[model samples]
Target: MVFRFAKTLDPITLFHAPSLQTSTNALNILKAASAAATAGTVTSNRGEFQLEITTAPPTTDQLRNIIDYVTANPAGAGSNKTDYAVGEVIKGAKDAEDAVKRFKEGGEGTFIRPITVDWTNGKAVLGDNESEILKMVHQLEAN
Candidate 1:
């Protein structure tokens, strides 16, 4: 008999802007969650994960991915304008195209901070709601 354990590659990324209080809070929360997961105090179907924290705005490709990920998962929009989910991630973007345009014009300054992305599970949470953030963190990975 052969025994094998598949490696877990799930990465939870936090797009943080140090100046913003909300982003700071989200960072702290994610840190705790990461610690809990490492300590086995937190359990998820996804099990262990690597938390990537970046103060820099995501790259253009990353921005598009974040927008798409959040759009597909509307819970990420929170109570914001659901009609234009892009605006939830990018401050003034009306849609995908507008998001790119505004991002080009304003650069990193236009991004709405404190977005946490669980890329492997296609889930993203925008803003500092501890509950929402934690929910996204510990949710099971869809098969």
Candidate 2:
């Protein structure tokens, strides 16, 4: 949704959100908010908008910060960014075994994974030594 600044009842600001676990850097939105809030009262700020995506996973810290922003900065009377977070991380675990244990116990969403790993790149690439090796590796790691 494209937001018109002048039409809005109050002024506004925006911030970039977490890019799943793939990235942990601030995007253009965050950069802009940083400039706006560089030296001022946060509550007095006109508004705050969170840039989020449905497909990409959201980090815990990102969700927390977004919730705080939504609570502190009212967005013209609306439930803001409630659907922005759709990510569940396997935290406090380093090893894969521990991570799986934590995820199985406390992970947010149910990851409906395929029964087997498909080695073919569509119909273009068939099975090969690489595929066989991958199959072996996939089998070595039990479900």
Candidate 3:
């Protein structure tokens, strides 16, 4: 057997892939950590933590939110094709990036059409709030 080096786990700053209410353990850990935290316990008197979300690595939920936003808020009179592309993403359940690309490539142009994506190749990860996703999608709609 060979020796392997491992670092100590940091409970206070846990970083788990965000999901749609899927990470119960992470929630538990946060709750426990917050409860245990006290003055000077974790550099802050209050149990405050910072969360960041990025679009480079979006999640399935984000994809859904984008579709929902596009559906609810139609961009323009000729945005039917764009809307349909969003539908294809949901029906196909494509990965977040793939879905975004589908909408971009298939939407707008009269000859454009949504394409199929191999769902097996998808490896989506969660970001922050769904509203953040809506903003990104809104930009797509404008284009």
* lDDT agreement of model 1 with the native: 0.80
Best by lDDT: 1
Ranking by TM-score: 1, 3, 2
The number of the candidate with the highest TM-score is 1
Cα lDDT of model 3 by residue, 48-93, tens digit: 3222222132244544454443342345665322233443434343
Residue 62: error of model 1 in Å? 1.0
Better of 1 and 2 by lDDT: 1
lDDT tens digits, residues 8-72, model 1? 76899999888889999999998998888878887776566889999888998888878877774
**Which consecutive 10 residues in model 1 have the weakest lDDT in total?**
75-84
- lDDT, residue 133, candidate 1: 79
List ranges where model 1 is wrong by over 4 Å: 1-6, 72-84, 140-143
